[model samples]
Target: MPGFLSLRTKTTSIVALMVAVTMACGGVMIWNTYRVDRLIEGMVSDSVAAYQAAEALETALVNQKGFMSYYVMDRNPEWLQRLGEYRQLFRMRLERAQGFAGTAEERDTLASIGDAYDLYVAAKDKALGLYINGDEIAGGEAHAGVRDQFFKILDHCEAYKKAHEEELFAARQAVHARAEQLRWVTVAALVFVTGLGGVLTLMLGRQVLAPLRRLAREEAGELALMEPNEVKAVTHRIENLIRSAGEAHTELARSRENLLMAEKMVLVGKLAAGMAHSIRNPMTSVKMRLFSLNRSLPLTREQEEDFQVITREIGQVDTIVQNFLEFSRPPRLAMQLESPSTVVDRVLQLLSHRLRSYEVTVEVKREKPLPNVTCDPEQLKEAFVNFMENACKAMGGGGRIVITERVVSETDGAGLAEISFADTGCGIPEEELEQVFQPFFTTREDGTGLGLPISQRIIENHGGWIDVDSVQGKGTTFVVYLPMDSEEKK
Candidate 1:
């Protein structure tokens, strides 16, 4: 059943994707239209540039030939060297004009231009050789025949240039007409594609997401009666729905577990109450009798000190019993606007004695003027104490601990206060990290293991998250991000 549903869903998704892609493709048509216009404009501009270069080269060739003719007619050696430079300029222009010719007619004109160019070069070379050989009179007579042939070649070059220009003009006009036609076609295609996309979006909205959303609601409504197998089946079919449903199931499981824990705590409280009643009277009598004996005894200083030690040990036992009684009873609501910095300071104060004895240093860095957060001050203190105590214990001997407070914004338009506690200690193993947050999970021999879990519950009740990151053999960092209330801001 899951496989069938998955296939159907995938098919629908693919169809919708194709529609979106086709719509995007249509958008490129307008760009194509503009590209065609540019092409036409470029063709005309390039052709004109080519024609101008050709015209300049032809004129330069004529000038160079005229100079060569004068040098030959007069048998002058001065103008010979300058002729080579002018010939180079003419070649450059001819090369440029060669690019503008496309069809057979244009090619034939270029071929004629090439023949004329060769004739000019041959006539100039012959004249220069004769002048160099010191046969001025003979060179002048030979130049007379070559000079007439040179003019005919120049005439042919000019005619070819005129014919090439006409062909380029006609080609430019045809290209412009084709470019306009392509532009209109592209525009029509673009409009049609855009309209197609809107239609596709409308179709998908009507066909896929709406029905899938309804199906999701239906599946959610039937979650409780679902067995593990049923859940697996649904997960295989609808992954997104499965994720949201998993959260709901998790919350339901937590509620059930908490109810069981509360029942167990009630039984423990009853036992604690009975046990206290049995021990309190005897402890009180002993404490009072010891107090009297200490004062009455006129003993040596060492003996008096021994007596004081006995009393102090008894008092410590009493304190432990009292703490147990308090733990059995639930705490009351004591929400207040308290500074996070003050909380960190108080926790540091509580750990001062141990900090000195263990040689552990605690550092606090806070953002200035932090907003107040509404929470039970005592619970917050307990959470911080539990975390700090755990961190200190993890360090084993001595380490640096850092605490910081800052505000952050979440994607949901809610502002949160983020508090971090980090310690340089032997970090938890990757396998053990997740279990560290569970009740009765501990790495220490004598740890109650309830400290972290209870602290987590307290924070969670106030709409906050407690996340842990640890690197084995490096350190651990615990982050608490809690949403802020309106009054807390000020």
Candidate 2:
């Protein structure tokens, strides 16, 4: 189906074309009227010319009368000569009037008028001849007849002139009225066409173009909305990426723990080797003393003193072996509710020798009513020992170590207990800080690099997490977060 404006335009064009054709025909009618009016003008002009010519003829006839009177009354032959000129003038005018007669009827009427004029001329000529022959009564009677006929011809000429002029005027008025009517019709049609065209233009714009434009605008708005939605989709994808990053971080942490366990085993093997090297001389002396004692010789005081030295060396070797075993294979937990402060205090006791040797100052701040945490006693002890030793090592010669324990309320559905170990030592470098908990990645050559990694594992296994804060050349802090006994629900 066609649109509203298209239909309207079709209707309007048809009407306009029809009106234009009709106006054109009206113009043709005006032309025809003009031609008819011209014909009437020609007829009117001929009639007026004929009437003037007839008047000239009448004046010539009067002059001939005067000439005849002079010929008859004074016997002047000159008058007769002049009479011929006057008669010739009157005949020429009569012939010219006859030439103007148009149609046969008009020509017959003009011929009748001409005949009357000829009769007047003939009578005048007769009168002049008679008067010349001295027949006065006959001459006067002929003159009177000629004058009557002359007046009758003149009256006929005037009547035709008046009739033709009236016809011309009536024709001109008819043509003018027709023309005015045509002009008014044409003007009305043009005005109608202009008004229709304007209406159609406005309707077309509103009904067709405007709607298309509105549709375009709506499409643009939809496109604009689509763009933002696409951006939102991109934003959602980005959020998914961030969540993936968090999961990846957790997996990476577990991988690091496994690596740390491997590295710890390697370090243990090396430590065992070093311990063997360190005890070799002690063992040799102990062996030599034992061998000598077995030779069945009497024991001397110096020899016995040597035996005691051997036994003491053996005891030192045993102690070193115990320490190595402890650090090498820390036991898995049989998790239970325990105080974090108690675990930290045990680690401090275990590292007391080195802590004293380095002149390290230590501070312990614990919540008076700290929440109970669930973890293995020995495993937690091992994790704390690693943290304490690292703190002491960072201090180098000496620095303050602050150990704090606090009960944290669940704010975001997580843990409720925290233990913090802070040391005033040269902090780890910013770039290296993230890698500190990675197994086998350490700044110090002597570092096994398993301490932080292992500690992180133990804490995570106990439903906890570890965080580190450090500034190069300043200090380092390690915080262990553990859920309370009641918070194990998490």
Candidate 3:
């Protein structure tokens, strides 16, 4: 709970949890995959080898059985030679089968078959020897007796083969069972990952986006968003902000100054504007005096440190108070015949260098020059500048801004000039739509959150309004609608 409120800490915790869960799922899947593969390999290698060996034993026993009978019938030495070869082949096959036998039961079965074959072979060999010695009667009698033993050996071979078949079948069933188990594991992991992803998304929305949205609405100047560093959230009052008006923004600052210092000041306008101008001048003078004192005055180390703190505090107060006074002051617009499209061109020209630094591109789309409207050109410029700069800040880098100008006809036959500024940047959430034009709503860190409210006020003063439409991840569009001069309506 020490630094628990920090965004970095919360975000790190959320991301780390998601990563841990993902890695755990992945590890299980990988382990299960390896286990299945090993099972399949072992089943094939062990069961298949035993089955093939059993079949070979059967073939060798059958081959030996007929050769001994043939020797007795043909009364030829060639048949006896073949019978001996078959006997050797049977023995070799029996040994191989014994080696392949995976279980003690299988080994015992093979051993029984071996003993039966040995007895059968002994009798067949004796009969063949008698046949070779030309004792036809005795040889035939002995070979006849060997047939029962031979059949017994055949029976043992068949049983051994059958046992191997059953073992192979059992192995196959085991493989299937393992595969099915793998499927369930996979399904469970998928469900877990999906649920984890949902939780991470919710955490991000609650821990990150909600605070950021609130931060945009509040006028807190600096926030400790993370640690050891201060972040300045932008405060935008669109039509007038001179602090962002350095170098490329100089023209914009001058324009806003003109909009504010118009000659036709009256009533509350005169008083508020007079007060702002009065306070601003004295603050500037005080800042200059403090700077001179800081350099020229010499004192003890402790006194010097105290003086520096006071100076910095005063500077902060001056800046904050000036922004507040200007935010509260009534704007005095120098309204005249001005083409908004042309005003946009000047703002682009003025902010060209700044836009380039952000690697942002702006495109203007219009069928033709828009009809002229009565507006304060300076205020319009400042507002357009705010929109463009906000677009640049929204995208962070390398995005497009499209400005479309057109004329729309109202139901009362009056035409309104529509200027749309669309940006390819992270869009605002729909739930916070109402707050986009609130008094101090800005998306940038370096700007005062006064642009939107001031821009809204400036547009309203010209009998116009601003509309915002945004879709998450796609982009946002800000459309300004202003009444065209009656005579110049398209």
Candidate 4:
């Protein structure tokens, strides 16, 4: 007993170890599954409920506006009653939204919305009272205040809902990434365990058999010393091991579903890159042919116009292919420390002719003594040009474009060089704002839709980010934040 572990004792110990490991693994899997499920459920519930509440509030406000308009125009008591109903609904929705606030910022926004709504309601009521009592002039003046309050409420709601939606989207992306990592870990665990089990089985078999073979060769003495209790203990351990293995196998099977999702993503990226490369040569040849034909053609006005249209279409296709190639095979950045204001001024100078043609006014405001940013000057200028051109196109006729630059601290407290392009042009719609950064998404008929995406890529390559804020029918602003140091290079 002091010098040796018997074959029966060794087998029993190994079996118990396997059982304990399997049970511990199963417990961890269960706990992790539960935690992920609970988090996903909470995010979905809170996001859905918050959005619904905001939508309900907006709908109630719209209804109130319609009913108020009807009452003002026709002096209808029924319309007033409907207005009151909508007013109550609005208050209820506001309270529900307040309850659903997911963050302190959201709570503050909701409070501001509630205050604005209350003021609007008060102004509306006073206007209605005056109008009913035959003071149209006073009622009109009071109603103007209601409009201002209403706009403020809308602004607050929009900001609150937009922030929450972004947060929810980020949370969902994180959950997906975590789930993907867990899947890979589980697959790796299974493979490791299978290999380990096979090795252990072979080593244990040799160890147990070698002892038995030596005992058999030696004499009947060792065989006679083997106890019935030891055999029984070994048998019990084998039974437990069999049961644990069966349970572990079942749990692993359940966890192994959809193992190819990450593989599919990798395959898709390679496929896209291949497809883009394949299309580029053909597209360039077609464009060259079209240009050659356009120059060589001698035709009537109608024929020339038709040829020009075809040539333009071919050019557009080439541009799209070029964009695809650019995206799939990005050029290496030539980084250098340069003044952001200088880049902005150069881009503005290059676009001056186009801006003049479009009747768009350009203004540059630089916070003096701003630190130089590390970036590819040419690429940064390209990004600035894209933004300026986008602003001009958005305006259509004429507008003011303001380029502001300053050194600022990023969200992570890192020093950043900030440049903003604010334009008095038609703003992006709320629903479409987030999608603007996505490749091949555009609102314009003639747009290739890769400008913003390419600009975003360039900025991100330089270790920066772009932030956009827009209000429909008012204007749009794009802020680019680049690191002051070449940390990305390091």
Candidate 2 local distance difference test against the native:
0.73
Which candidate leads the pack in TM-score? 1
| lDDT against true structure, model 3 | 0.77
Q: Which residue runs of candidate 3 sit more than 4 Å off their true CA positions?
A: 1-12, 102-104, 129-141, 201-490
Q: What do the candidate models score in CA lDDT, each in turn?
A: 0.74, 0.73, 0.77, 0.78
Name the runs in model 2 displaced over 4 angstroms: 1-330, 413-415, 487-490
By lDDT rank, best first, the candidates go 4, 3, 1, 2
Per residue, candidate 4 scores C-alpha lDDT tens digits across 1-490 of 2228775676676566666666666766777788788878888789868877887777777777656667879877999887788788888999998899878977888888887887788888888889889898998898888888887777777777677778678878877877776677667667666765775587666876555544444443344346334344444555667899999998786566334433533554565577567875777787788778778977789988887788777777767666666665678999887888888878978988999999999888865735677779999998999899999999999999998887777567678888999999999999999889766679999886779988998999998999999999989999998888745222
lDDT tens digits, residues 351-458, model 3? 999999999988999898788999999989878987887888889878999999999998998999999999998999888877787544565555556667668778
Clashes of each: 0, 0, 15, 0
Give all TM-scores, in the order shown: 0.46, 0.40, 0.41, 0.42
**Of the candidates shown, which would achieve the greatest lDDT relative to the real structure?**
4
Candidate RMSDs in order: 12.7, 27.8, 19.7, 39.1
Select the stronger candidate by TM-score from 2 and 4: 4
Using alpha carbons, what is the TM-score of model 2?
Answer: 0.40
For residue 424, model 1's alpha carbon misses the true position, in angstroms, by 1.7
lDDT of 1 at 276: 94
